[model samples]
Target chain A: MSIPRNWRTRQQRYSLKAEVCNTCNKHIFPPRDVCPHCAAEKQSWTNLSGQGEVFSYTTMYNAPAGFEEYAPYTMALVKLAEGPMVTAQLTDVDAQDVKIGMPVEMVTRKLSQEGEEGQILYGYKFRPMLREAA
Target chain B: MRDVVIIGVGQTRVEEHWGKSLRHMAHDAVMAAMKDAGIETADALYVGNMLSGELGGQEHVGALVADFIGLRGIEAMKVEAACASGAAALRVGMFAVASGIHDVVMVCGVEKMTDAVGDEVTSGLATAADQEYEVSQGISFVGLNALLMRRYMHQFDVKHEHFAGFAVNAHKNGANNPNAMFQSPIKAETYLRASMIADPINLMDSSPVCDGAACVILAPADGYRARAKAHILASAVATDSLAIHDRRDPLTLDAVALSSQKAYAQARITPTDVDLFEVHDAFTIMAALSLEAAGFAPRGRGVCMAVDNEIGIEGRLPISTMGGLKSRGHPVGATGVYQIVEVVAQLTGQAGKNQVQGARIGMAQNIGGSGATVITHILGGV
Candidate 1:
């Protein structure tokens, strides 16, 4: 990935920054200027709680380009407490133990390194929340 | 608007054509279609392709294929909607003929996926999903479907075995199709024993990656009334959120429902009127979802239709009559036109062994992405 492009969206990648529409009162992850639901332009940036349940998930045995090292990793659609769903990799948990409705918390982690000389990208990944904490 | 009729259809066997370049495959199909139509040239050519740039390092395939076929200077362009590119191009061709702008329009869908390695093709297919959120998370295309399949099983309390019949029936019908990539039949037991690509999504559930090209000639029904194979009863395209998570319900495909409903309205018919349906069975889950979204079955019960053997050619609401994307091989963009070509074959009584008995009306639904872009076309035999 290009350095400029990766740097531009660092806030969302690092902090789980999302947008909330004033009109629709709906939250959108990976912030967009316009609200997809209400078509409203009045939106505010907010940091998500980074805590949610797994809506669905999969263990990706076949990794895509730049993700070969993370083969057999689990990825999930984590439904945040604020109501928006975010797709993220599941860390600190075995794929076999991952199930729907499993509580998870987001944490910043290295996503991938572009090329040998390219930038090392870091993004938020979800890990299973401790049962006692819930 | 003038009514458009499909006069001719041609396609290459869905297989790994390592010797054929994209232009060569397109030329073969276009020439075959033109020969079938008994025409020398067409007013316009619309080529539907997904990844010529990513996989083949080539773009502007419309002009390239048109010139290669010796039909240069006519309005030629490429139409892309991920995997639904073929049907999207066909939709454009339909509009061209209906508007009286082009007398004869050629729509070809071609893809050369086998030229690239497996991981490269996998990465290319992942472009169909959300690049920023979904693919950035290192999920493959099959990984996305695996999540869906797992969720569907949990949500509906369905078993993995329920989805086996779709592949079995597809392979069974494919055995009779000369152009299908996998002509050998598969059993449900084989589906169960197949190695897992992703957890819950076995090797048997996925369509093979291959190269293919399918072409169709559309003209005004006024002149070719007697010889036309099928009339374009209805053509509709609809879209939903590109990312599956954005949908109101992940299990429901709003685009498929909307497109099929729109097509049904335009054709003045209901889903039951369709004798055969060529659905995009890129995955077995996709087949079930498409069936549910297109009104073939209730929500969360699409797999039941497969389990009950209702999708067979001899059964009610025959689906994937000529092998579908499963056994015919999904060459991405080419799959949509292949569906249309197979539908024409059934309509014209050209489908030798895979013909659906008394097929008068047929529907073909080509889906792009998880369920984002859906193009539905309803055809009627003359």
Candidate 2:
């Protein structure tokens, strides 16, 4: 995560802003321009409810290089209410507490800390929701 | 299009190879193939590799290997498709000959990962997925497959033990392969009790990261018909979303289905007609998914054939006939060519103790990410 790279993705990370193809009415997350469904260049944007359930999940015993301190952390594919699954670290939940179709909602959280004295990266991560969204 | 025939095949034993440099390992495989083909030179060279730029701290591998192999002036370049780099290079060389671009071409697949420090290879491999979306979440490649495994178990009511047969089969065959990284077979208990890396994906389920190289020399089938080892009946490639979460049904590997379907059409044969399948068993989950996607088994039941002992050399559809990624070692980019060399051995009756009896038709499917870039090649005795 370089400065510019992290800076550019702030919107998607901080707010769960995803692309919605008005043509096919499909959702694209991590916000790319091209509509994979209908190839519509012109698309609308929407802030996702960030409400979803766990599609599949895993716990990384050994994390990647920069994120080593968070070893043995739970990560999951959160199938969103908006209809697109997003990959995110599960927060405020233990690996034992996770399950398929476990109801969750997106929240702003610290993703990772850069090198010593560097910037702290914030992003959207999922946590167990108290109840289902209406 | 001109029909392409493999004139020669060669490979180095898959292992750590801490002693050999990337270029030297590649040179050895290329020279061995040249010797087998009794050729002094070729018009072009194609190198298939991944992580050279990251792990090896080197790029432009195409020119590097050519210059080291003593054919500096020839046309050379590297084809990279993550772990499918080996087969991707083979596909490119086949095109060169089939399209009348070149008469003879040498394709080498190589990867050296043991030289790097902590998580260098691990993070390097994560580049195969969507960097911003997938890798940023801190999931290693094993973690990604583990996600699929968990979902698979949940959806189909499959247990983790059911997948052990895949590793058992690969290791059983790998024990017979002298060039394999792990030369001994393990019992089902070994798989059941293996240390867990990512939850649901035990150590046994994952392919060992090592180093090696494989090469195949391709030429026009017209003049080489008498000396052909195997004819390239089909070469097809297809890709899906880089992010698994982006797919409609993450369980179904659409890329594998499309690529193999195209290959079957080109080869004019069904799955029943094929003798063996050199599947990319990077993970046990991948093996199961590939079998289903390639139509070798019904959806959600790829492990059934393995559990029933039908994946052996004497069974209906033998796979990973020469150790596979699990036992033979997945040198990443080199795995595709290794599968081709093993298939040639089976087709030509050179497989010795590991030979699939009366083998003629064999297919090798090389998958790159989880199931993103898939390349399938069908080879047979001409």
Candidate 3:
């Protein structure tokens, strides 16, 4: 029917968002409806700085049905500096630069083009932390 | 929870069913199980059919089967856990009885994989992984498992011959199993010499894509027939990190170990007490990993067990007496129930050629997606 609830909710976070548990005082990245640590229904959503460290990653040579053009892309699980772990692509970085414990920051951008049309699916991705360009 | 027992189980031989329709495939399995249990009707029905809605444009399978089997107006539902959908449906039936609700229930798992083309089937199966990330990167199930196998070999210093032994042993067991998809025996050298699909895993090392159906009936202890009285000693499941790269150690299947430990504990039996097992050997490396995860062997020693012939029926702990998914076939949703049916047959002394000697205690392990979701069950012949 409608897009599954989780998929819809995740799609709304075009950028980075975190779930802060009031009871346990833990920030869960990729927010959930409830706090898993404290079992509390009370949670607050906050935009994250998108700064994190790479926990682990892999580069895929073969892609799935729709994402064939994005092959040779890197995917990583990045643990945020605040709290919460999120998985996303590492953009604008050389494959050789991808490694465990690598410092990364989230960046909102278009991930893939929709069908033959130019419709874009905007999503959050990660990249190696770099000095801000003036 | 009330004690639940499996009373009937049946499955059709897996192969290329060119003429069989999906509904007929399911009907044959459910009817066989009903005949085996000597029950004309069940109070409830639970069906697990993966990719049916996507591939066959068929949904509401529970109602469809219930109507066909003349169990109209009964409680019916479908359970899906990707490839482990059948076992998930069994879990639902077990819970229905254990919760002291319905006493007799039918659990069936079916998949018509041959209905689709090869590339389409590959894409559909890949949906089980992280679609946005992993699948989008052109990774199929074979490629993912192959990566896992490659990593295990690198970490353990095991040779490629170890995987070859696993395949050869499964083929030997499958040869004796009439229901197996590949009953013809293959040599280890021949397997090693096959073409590579993914690095380290050859064509023979992987489970074939086939179409089949398996059904089992669950009821309270009092409702079980004499032939169907193999007690459902315990059913336990566990989950690991969803994504492959999220695991702390890719080489170790944490979910398998955890689920098996809980199931064995609940059954009050150790791995040594299990007379035989039907593990999730979707890949040859998976069979080896499952043995290690089940505590039958130490870490990195699964290859040694296979090479020493300790994994066969006459060995210390016979694994996959039904040829496993490797040789028996992987029909996705039906595989878990198929494993349960095989164990029930062995315990009931009904499995002819694939029967283990003096099979008293049997255990089964059905894993999903590289050990992300592992469901384990222990059954005993009382």
Candidate 3 ranges with C-alpha deviation above 4 Å: A1-63, A67-114, A118-134, B223-225
Per-residue lDDT over B1-382 for candidate 1, one digit per residue giving the tens place of the 0 to 100 score: 9999998899999999989999999999999999999999999999999999999899999999999999879999999999999999999999999999988999999999988888899999999999888888788899989989999999999999889999998998999999999999998899999998888898999999999999999999999887698999999999998888788888999999999999999999988898999999999999999999999899999998894349888888888888999999999999999999999999988899888888999999999999999999999999
TM-scores, each model vs. reference: 0.98, 0.99, 0.82
Task: List clashing residue pairs in candidate 3.
Answer: A62-B137, A62-B138, A63-B137, A63-B138, A64-B138
lDDT of 1 by residue, A1-134 (tens): 57787888789899988888999989988777788888889988788888999999988878998998878899888889999887789999988899899989989999998878878999999998865354
**Whole-model lDDT per candidate:** 0.91, 0.92, 0.79
Decreasing DockQ order of the candidates = 2, 1, 3
Candidate 1 ranges with C-alpha deviation above 4 Å: A131-134
How are the candidates ranked when ordered by lDDT, highest leading?
A: 2, 1, 3
Best-to-worst ranking by TM-score:
2, 1, 3
Q: Per-residue lDDT tens digits of candidate 3, residues A1-134?
A: 01353256464346565668888888765556777567788887777777888765556554455556776666665677876666567899987777666788777776666477645556778888885422
lDDT of 2 by residue, B1-382 (tens): 9999999998999999989999999999999999988899999999999989989779999999999999999999999999999999999999999999999899999999999865877898888988889998888898899999999999999999999889999999999998899999999999999999889999999999899999999999998898799999999999999999988699999999999999999999999999999999999999999999999999998878775357888888999999999999999999999999999999999998889889999999999999999999999886
Identify the leading candidate in terms of lDDT. 2
Fnat per candidate, as a fraction, reads 0.77, 0.83, 0.14
